[model samples]
Target: MLQVFRKFFHSSVGVFAALGLIVMLAMAFAAGDVSNMMSSGSITGGDRVAKVGGNTIGTAQLTKQMQQAVEITRQQQPGVTMKSFLAEGGLDLVLDQMIDGEAQMAFGRKVGIVAGKRLIDSELAKIPAFQGAGGKFDQNAYLSVLAQRQMNDADVRDSFARDLVSRQLLAPAQFGAALPQSAVMQYAALLKEHRAGSAAMLPSSAFAPKGLPTQAEVSAWYNSHKAAYTVPERRVIRYARFDESVIKQSSVPSDAEVAARFKANAAQYGASETRKVSQVIVISESMAKDIAAAVAKGESLEAAAKAKGLSVASLGSVSKADLTIKSSAAVAEAAYAAKAGATAGPVKGALGWALVRVDAIDAKPARTLEQVKGEITAALTEEKRKQALAALTEKVNDDFGKGGALSDTAKELGLTMAETPLLVAKTPAGMGLPAELASILPAAFGMDHEGQPQISELVAGKSFVIFDVTKIIPAAPAPLDQISAQVMADIQLEKGSVAARAAAMKLLAAGKKGGDLAAEVAKLGVALPPVQQMNLGREEIMSRGGQIPPAVALFFGMAPGTTKLIPIAGNKGFMAVQLKAITPGAVAANDPLIGQVKGELNNLAAREQGESLRRAIRTEVKVERNESTIKTVTSTLAGGN
Candidate 1:
């Protein structure tokens, strides 16, 4: 049993249980002949959608699972409508997963692989989400989490039992998977291979003539790409903010009240003495006494331990209240009484006898009421101000609910009202508004243009705002005259790029026919670019003096001496690349890369084997479809009348 747990922990399933649970749930709900099952209405024992060996899944069970899936979907996406969920194939997926889970469970039962109550309870206790404040399993927390997902204790236990049995049955595939050494070496070599190449850059600016585009050309370009120039619809918002700063200074607590408050929480103002100590725990009192004596003779506790084949562990700094270990109270009392550099104790502890040495004392002085009066007053004032702000925020929300105008509400509440400039969906940085308001822009844009005013929290509840969309500006293309200068520049650059490409092609043709590249470029009144060698790999491309152009990195897939023209940035130029050589990187048989590849390959094989086993079990199981029940459930969840 111990070995089984050990093997399960070392397997892929154990390491990825949390992620795998979600995936398994999805798959369990997404399998089978869902279309046919949804078409039948009066389903009896004959309505079994599937029978794994002797176990049958009837329409009633399928209906229950579908309802649970709907609840789960609602919990996952709070505001998702039924239509949207079904449109995304959520129902179909759920049915499939349910069929798959039932098939697996039936197979497990057939093979006598059942999870006992003890195992189920043990696994439940290990889930961190079910633990509470004291770090122990809390029944209330466990029930609450399940309730949130519309799941009960039995449902959870059953799911976990199925998962356990499935894993146990599939253990052989997961534990005994490995990849061939040759496959590992081949993958490693491919990943490490590098290529060398040279490139010549042709800049469009060198070929562009000084001129503006003809009227016909400009109109044609604008007509063909009007969508690119059109702006998105934008909104102008007006809002009124309410915060603690609006609270009156006269509302602050008086000095007497501050002193009274401090008195009520006196323990918070008190301090406890902390001592830094180190101790060596040994099996016997005589051993502890010998170590204490050695320390008294000017030998360090660490040196004493090393001589005795032991180690000293630091207790760090701790107060008396924090000393919870056995005999810790006695150790703390002894160490606190002694001055710094003092040694004490061969004290008996739960583990063994302990030898303690005091390193330092930190005596925190108690703070007087007068010393903390300002802090208490400030805190009380802030609390009162927050209370006032909360009330004001509620009042603002009430006013908005009553259909009060934003400007009128600001006037009535005495809040500062302001209007934002026309803003797009994506708010740019450095906008006048604070980050909190900027974060709300996306949500605001998603709302109906003429929707009711919204009250949003800001600065993590420090402030609040009641905002409404004041106006919406429809998107339109800018006038041609307004952007004529930029348009003319673009036209010139386009013409320049065409000329540059033509010149590059001419040089390429000449070079291919044994013409000197430098001489050919010189004839066209252009300087020939110096050829620089580069080694390109998956990581990056490098030359002797600097990094090569990223466009030349594509040469890695080309054969040696192959040539191609790759585009440069901004539609402004092209880089003519010539592959010079290919070099395969050397990878040792025992390299870490080879091991990583092997691990991934083995994981893939394990997954395939598990799938095959599941399929085999499914094939042996008999299945029947009740199409009417499925269609009824699907129609109801999809909001059909």
Candidate 2:
């Protein structure tokens, strides 16, 4: 309930939406700005990008957030274009939301709400992003990720704490119990899924609403939403993107270097102790008591294991460290029931009825130096190769920077210069190039451009680059010859529009009379498969389902076996559908939304209750900022959309 959400929202870390922030963190990484390393710059907008008690938000932070939103949006509509996204106001809205969020965060701090380490750690623990394959907090993984993200422990702790504080302020106001439960449930459904019935749909063709304005109608509609038809300005580009990967073929590691690396990181690279054991799973403690009781009364252990839903495994002997069973106290207690010579009995484990007879156990011993030498050699050699590769890349970049041509460097390094086909500023088909490349590509075609190796900032790594554009192609509209067949098909489909409408109308009338849509299709000599049920969710209701007909989504909300007509005016073909039984899709709502309004509301409540407490602490702290600098920075980034 919103009320329940409200009750916990001001806790500096609530049960629900902090998890969302965590989810967003993963998305931010996938969006390729997980580091957010730059929070100290200015923007184009007159409006300050970040203002916290006059300590302006950093440009680096602003850019990272923008990049994060861009990445997340791309995931939402993968392969979406910048022009299209900008037209939709999608990227601008996302950017504005982020800036607003940062402002609010500053406001929260000024108002005297601070998140503590305990809260930060608690929330971090719950984040699935930190959990490794074993499903526990993985320190190594955390370190590697943080390093890659250019994050330190302190920065993470602070960011996490701030996010928690934000959540504490926002969630409760959005869902507080002062609102009626009905309101909560209503919002819940709007925001979530309901498991129930299936649906079918009726389409516009059936009930052709008569508004034939001749050619005038089409022209009018086009004029109203003319932005949709307007051509996007594009650029012709010649770029040279060069990275080490394309040019370098991996070579086998030298035996000496591999051996060295293997020895240096031997603790990390070597194998682990593995074990084999049998398992018994049960539900209740009482049932486990019963099973144990029976087993202790001279029942065969195999029988006891069989009486329970357990699977047995055989191993000559395996190391204890390798056994998953040994990792648990419950399993350990059960397994250790007997000495090496004896069998253990009806001892309980954490999950269920688990009794272990230590069939065999092997102690882990250090691997001999000779036995691991080859692996070590290989690993060390690879490390050397990586270092060499990195040095080579740096050398090439240095050469490129010092007025050296890509061709010149390629020759000197014994590297081959390869060319990419035309990739205009706006059109990129390669997996490596992103929309941001548009900004960089123009420079490749600008003054003093030719033979000037355009080294780009490292994307995934310091070594990565988008190679030079070998060809520049201007955007072209479909040529007559190329689109002749398509034009003919369009002419046929367009000309048939009147007849199709008339026939579809008759079917709609029949469908309203409870006739099967399939029956109508048969009368028209067109075939369609019988309706099959599918559960549609936010992620699935897409263009891929784009072909399924708009009726797919609209019909799911209709009553079973009923008819409701709708129109599909998009890229996929037009379709008609009848409402089948409503199959309510999913189960329960998991979490609540935390918007800026909700957060502001939470802050007001916090202020009333603990204003004096926070004021006293803030009065003891010192804060100063250069407002002019911040204003200059944030403004450049503002007002675009």
Best by lDDT: 1
lDDT tens digits, residue span 1-641, model 1: 22222332344443233222322233332132222233323334455544444445555656555554554455447777667767888766666566666666667777788889999788767666666766678999777766655555765666667666666776665677777787778777877777876667788877787766788888877777667677788888777777766655455898888988998999888986877888888898888888888988999989987788899877888776665453467776776777888777887766788777788888888999889988998999878777777777788778878977777777766888788888888768447455658866876677677536878887765877778887787788767777666666777888889989998898678656655544556677765466455666744543333555465556766677656677778988777766666777679867887877788888998888877876676775544445665676667666775
Instruction: At residue 86, give the lDDT of candidate 2.
Output: 49
> Distance (Å) between predicted and true CA of 29, model 1?
12
Clashes of 2: 71
Which consecutive 10 residues in model 1 have the weakest lDDT in total?
A: 28-37
lDDT per residue for candidate 2 within 1-641, as digits (tens), equals: 12332333334333233223332322221111122432433443334343333344345554444444455456446876444654566534544444433444555676677678777666555545466766677777666656655556766665565455555655444343233444445444443433232323233233333444344444444445445444333433333344444435564665665566567777754555443455455667676666567667877556765776655445335444433444366565545445553445445545555555565544456675677777666665566566766777777778767877656665665555444444444455343344545456556555343455665654544344434434443344444445444444443444445555555676678777888766665576433334444455433443265565555666555655665555446322235556544433332444444232245445555555443433333333322333454444444444432
lDDT of 2 at 559: 59
Give candidate 1 regions above 4 Å deviation. 1-24, 27-99, 110-112, 129-150, 188-192, 199-211, 238-384, 409-419, 432-436, 439-456, 460-471, 489-532, 537-553, 560-580, 584-604, 611-641
Cand. 1 TM to true fold: 0.60
Model 1, residue 218: C-alpha shift (Å): 1.3
Give the Cα lDDT of each candidate: 0.68, 0.49
Off by over 4 Å in 2: 1-74, 78-273, 279-354, 359-366, 416-448, 454-641
| Candidate 1 RMSD to the real structure | 8.6
